[model samples]
Target: MRHVLAAATLAVSATACVSTATPDTEPKGVVVDPISWGPCTDIVRPDGEPPARQEPGVRCGKLTVPLDYDNPDLGTIDLALIKIAATDQSRRLGSLVFNFGGPGGSGVDTLAQAAKMFDTLRTRYDLVSFDPRGVDRSSGVRCGSNADMDAYVELNTLPPTQKTREAGRAANQRFAELCKRDASRLLPYIGTGNTARDMDRLRAALGDAKLNYLGMSYGTQLGAVYATKYPNKVGRVVLDAPLDPSVTFRQRTLAQTRGFQQAYESFLKDCVKEGCELGDTVKAADANVMRLMYKLVDKPLRVGNRRLTQGLASTGLAAALYSEGAWPFLETALAQADKGRGDALIYLADSYTGRSKDGTYTTQMSSFPAITCVDSAERPDEGELTRTWKEAIKISPLFGSEGAGGICTSWPVAGNNEARKVNAKGSAPILVVGGKGDPATPYQWAPSLTRQLGNATLLTYEGQGHGSYSSGNKCIQSMVNSFLLKGKVPNQDVACAAA
Candidate 1:
């Protein structure tokens, strides 16, 4: 999902035939037959070769969920699931479902690429994931082609002027309209709360006593909502890179604004130590970046068929800031852009906005706002938005405007759930992880969220990255493994050294 610094899928099962006798129900009294699982299909690699780390016994299936949980009989939608069954089934605890950020990220795709990352868990429990409704492989939204999205994401100016603001407003409205036309049925049903409800149904269908879950980035929000809605039913849940759920949309942007700024500073310090060619000093590098951003505003750089604009450049930088691993690549992109070669930065932007090489989008941007906007209570009118626009400018001159809410203002509907602190009182002890250098969900969010919940433990990777456990940090991995497999929470906040 492309965050207009709008911030912000998934599978189930491996090679086992699992079934339940209890029938699935749709609201009121519509009793549907029990869901049946069998052989998985359509597991092909685009490159014509399987990934080196494919899950050994992965199984694929579809679970039918109510399109509208409020009125289950309203309709039904298919949530595609994939499971990597535990190699040591005799020692299996239960299913450990995982969500890899992006309200639009395909869990099946991500888990496939990083199957080895979950190797430790696969030995103890089956790893299950599902494409949330409105995400890829589900009944997803398709608003525009890659060309249309490219133009939208690569807008040149900030929303500082009425004309500029109107331009963003129009694009947002256009996207909402396109979604209405392309995915009207799923639009009203898409939201964090609804997805959480769907999760409960999935839990029942899977025959789990409770849900054992791991959610990253936006997935943290999903897990939080689930815990809030089903506190008593909660199992072991790890929310990595979490959000301060009580905050409003504008607040969310401000958090990211400061977060990206700090993460960039961290990158700069490392850059100078590594003797990268960014600048001689920190001040010079900062000035160079600001100047380059404004330079793109007045005169965009040509990258193949597209011109790299200020927004694209900013988003590219923001994307790279998610992990310190990308700092070197970001330095190279910036150095090349300074020298009038914009291809590298363009690729970064493409990765951020979900534009494929074939000139089509993957429904990320379309579903991102639809789900995010509806999940919130705030629906600022034009006046409040204009004020937010100015505040965004003052916060981070390079990204403030985009960091704030421009896209959600034009949302066709207000979300079903109101923004508030999630107490999750009856839920069991839950683990919340944060990365100090995480730019997407700032490190502070972990503590803030921990304080909000009734029995939440904070785990900090006093290091750089968006997530901790799966990124190969031994301490973080051990803690997460113990929590999931043995239902143990750290006695106190555990801080791990940088990887």
Candidate 2:
């Protein structure tokens, strides 16, 4: 998930190498280091429970990896890793690494949270998760003060006109300047390719012969880069909510705009069917909601003592659009907003900003954008951005083009040398999953990415939301669990209904 604040709306949404010598020599594209293993320290494990107690059958460990792979001597970073050691040790499958969506999301947190659902796979192999570079408890990258982040969220997303485009450009320039001043050293090294390389290093350090992995949202892109660069070293891999490697930054954002629009429409249709509070007719309710958004853009509403601005309202709306599970709350919020009550919208905005009622942000919004600005290429300039925004808005009026292109354009860095299409020809069979109604990474991206990888099978979850695995879909969980556990790939397309 790419959560960068542009005008208050947090829009959520790699590789190569060479050289070979002999059998005992380092592989052609592999970066080898002297094997070093030591007792894991960095983290102070919780006290009440055993420091490293296994969750069901999974064992946990903390691994120290170099903050910068190119300059391992610089410093070391700690990654919290959890593992479900293979049950069938005699016919043991290798470790399967899992990553949740956020570029700044913690895989360890995902593992800890989803351990129970994943126990089935523990019977076959270790299920592992580690925080990627620039994330929680992993030597993360921090930027300007909370005020700066607040200003960032207020940055505009709509650049439909030349004037708006210029505004966005200025915002981008200012943001870039701030990031450069605050985090120059760490900014340049956070792209997907580097993260992929980090994964490889982790795999080697953990003593895995090959990388067995499961990635979702941004994780899909990371896995794609790894497969392309180290195809031969890849074991069973699963990529959910796959991103289209060919699309430009602006194009990708625009696509997400359309996705949110579709998702909102789906929500409206569903609400109408259920005769929800938002409205009696789905179309009527949608129109009212759009009107409310436009109104907020002009004049923000007040929720008790808090002032809810248009930008923040939009951000909340975008965040709510993320999952079907959020639709009900979104509808209620929209209804309240329609009635001139802004508290619901304010609460939603608070959730989007990762802010608590006591006025504290939950590391998510702060860390999310810091990682995003570094991972992808530069945002487009004023003229180009304006043109793109106009086109995108026309494509999806509900999410207005300017709204979609807002965040990244203001990112601090220029494009790094990240490979667009990964060549994963020799990689083991990889499973690619897509949600039919994913407002972030659309389902269409699955087939495209599958085709890009020489050995990939597309798995379709005819459902809604960002990820499919272990999220209540028995079929997807079973398929993914089985694949990670025993290298089993479904012979044909696997489909699951929206729950």
Candidate 3:
């Protein structure tokens, strides 16, 4: 659901009836059922990853939502959910829902892994997260086999030539065919609007009068769509690393290209100050990185039994740019790559792609394409894609041309691009968190979304990362906590100094 840094990163099967309702609209007579919680079982994990920790007081449940809300009788799908109830029940406000981005990110798994981070907030609210429709354990979409995905990620889409463009399209078409073959029934309904509707359903299931949410990265997009559809239901909402709903697919992609370029430059400057081995100056370090990427295009790097292609290298680099703390690792990865070892870079790439040591891939990769293709409406023509790629290369030669039209170019289903202008008039106050150096969702989009949601306030974190609250900056956390906990909306936009 983001700028496709590489075809590999642009990465589910479901059974249900075709959706006949207008996309993202809740039809009359909709019903919400209470979730039946029990011991956490059936939690999906990467092939080699261990099972979810059995945290005390944690419960797991499934919410059954209509596969086609427009035509409820069509069928139903069960959404996987997890919850850590408030420690101080007497002081509890309600359940606080979270969407950890990825459009396809498995909230069930993420919440369980990162629950410790929310301990303070959990004292007054049950921290809840779910694998939204078309995500893991929720009728997640699956495409080709692990081996097929291995080939898919390594497909080179760079240099924006006729040959490379055609190859990219062919690979996308093949991957799309696999998804259609595996998940045709559910593909048409896997957009943000439906997921937002699922969130409303979730809110009702949790017995909340208003929806309280924390959404980061692409999660911010999902939150915005929800506010657009159910403005009055909006409670205390915090959208960190906000995505601008107003931008078209191409515009978002181009902006991300520039964002990543800026983040990379920032990283290089830090590396130089630290006396990094890559170069003595930022410009030289950048050129060396470009040279490595170009070299990998023709000669793959060997990491044990796996080969690292240029596309995977780019994915690894982009993944690192998501957080400033990862810059040191990126520097180390680059240094090792310069020494002809690709293991470290491959590790970063695998982390982003969710590839396990045993070679099985997570459903997130499959669902990413399913969700993004339907959420984004820009179906650019060949010429348009070529032009965008050219512009991207000019913005960041190392990262710009990794993706052209992304998997959407060959998607089997059309996108609805719901609520492009999300004017959540009269909605409850929202806190929009923007990290000045965020590479994935740029800082500029925060003000854009805050302005659109008239009742929202902008909280700027002068930091470098994809998210703000999770950055552990006390100033940011305090402000966000105050808003989520006590409904303390800042009278004016506030900027937190970087720590």
Candidate 4:
């Protein structure tokens, strides 16, 4: 789900924890059983096709888990799972698990989309994606009011001074208070550690020896945690846009600030080389754009009747920072904002916020803060907060000060888990993928995580974007497919360019 930037960053480190008890010893109340097949009402096939008739061997089932792992007797949650039983019955590989990027991303939704892209792998091994605890269609954590979420998004996450910091702190307190009032019971259980345990339960019910996983962004960190806790059960793991599990939330946000700065520079250079309409020189283009951001900060512009303020401008800029494919659109929005036009930029900002034209919001960001607040352990002391904000502004005048600084200050609770060195020892060989120009999860993070995971191989995509597999890069797709299917690792660091 889309939390404010801080929540999204912290969610990367929140995967389920492994039970300390040995595999032979089941916890007293944890139940594991295979669910019967039924018609999947939620399955949405591309182009209105009927659910692909279950290939002769595929199995669809649900795995039930406890709402709280610490107190298994409290209540049970149903996790939906789908398995494409191996066609090579003679040499069946184990279950290949997946989580689509969001700590809020739907694994079931991902499978529905992946059905076409990964038909080959589907036939060879069972591909499974369960709704992690606290997600749509699974036992979910709700915050009763969208007002709480709106307040969070509207908070000045870009606190620059003591006054702004105080404001952000107040906002955080208010949001936390709302959560405690409405969703107190669900708070502790939505973290990543429990999600990883849920995966293990799914594995046990499915009777798999190890988890073969492909995860991206936040999902990559989830896979990493699973490998760390259950190394012996790791098989052909791939972590794309990997998160460095050892960095604190502030550190990660700062790193992301730098990453976006780097990506912006890359975009400027390319636009200049291409003689794009935005500008002729990278320096000129950057100065003009940054000027627009500052101007908006002081006085919002009007597009017909709607007012586009600094917050909306910052949101638009953050959305643009997500992928290089969005550069031209960003340029156009920037140009329009420069001429006192704000509708285009406002619409882009709305899209990033998951706000529709009709003024309704999807639940993507609703549970984001709840999960993030509990996952991270780091809290920025006043001094550290001041210094980080100053540094961010110096590096990225438009995004650093505004987008990086605000969310964590008022986090309702201190995070339970802090980013720390992750040495996934004894884990199976894991593949790490990095995009050269990914704004949110930088390429540098891939190498950092690869070095930390004892058995990881780095694969580089010399392209721009957040993800590689479906990002229109053949080399990336080939490399990942080969690794997932044949269990072969890249010979050395591999590089992929846009095809």
Off by over 4 Å in 4: 1-30, 36-62, 80-95, 110-120, 123-127, 155-165, 298-307, 339-343, 403-409, 418-421, 497-499
Is 1 or 4 the stronger prediction by lDDT? 1
Worst 10-residue lDDT window for candidate 1 reads 10-19
Q: List per-prediction Cα lDDT, in the order shown.
A: 0.73, 0.66, 0.80, 0.67
Which residues of candidate 2, in runs, are more than 4 Å off?
1-62, 80-94, 123-125, 155-166, 303-305, 340-343, 356-379, 402-412, 497-499
* TM-score of predicted structure 3: 0.92
**Each prediction's Cα RMSD?**
6.4, 5.8, 5.2, 5.3
Q: Could you tell me the TM-score of candidate 4? A: 0.82
Candidate 1 residue-wise lDDT, 1-499, digit = tens: 2211111211000011111112223345534334465555544232223345434487778888778766867978898888888989899888888888787776765665556678888898888888788988888877766666777787755535667767777777887777767777778778877787778877877778888999988888788777777777789999987877776666777777777778888888889888868888888888888788888888899877679898889878877777566678899999999999888887777676666556666667787887877777678787878777787777776666666556776777767443243667668889999888777777877888887776789999988767776556799999988998888788686789986
Count: clashes, candidate 1:
15
Candidate 2 TM-score over all chains jointly:
0.82
What tens-digit string does per-residue lDDT give for candidate 2 at 1-499?
Answer: 1111210121135112221211121236655453333333332211112236334454555666566767767776666666656667786666778777666765664565455555677666677777677665666565566667667666544424556556655765676667668767666666677678778877886678888887878788788888777776788888977877666767676778788888878888989998888778987887787788777766678776566666677777877776666677788888888888888777666656655555544345545666665555656666766666677778775576445445666665665535465657766888998888888887777887787776788888888766777345888888887777767888767677765
lDDT of 2: 0.66
- Model 3 Cα lDDT, one tens digit per residue, 177-228: 9999999999998888888989999998899999999988788878887887
Q: By how many angstroms RMSD does model 3 differ from the true structure?
A: 5.2
For residue 184, give model 3's deviation from the true position in Å.
0.7
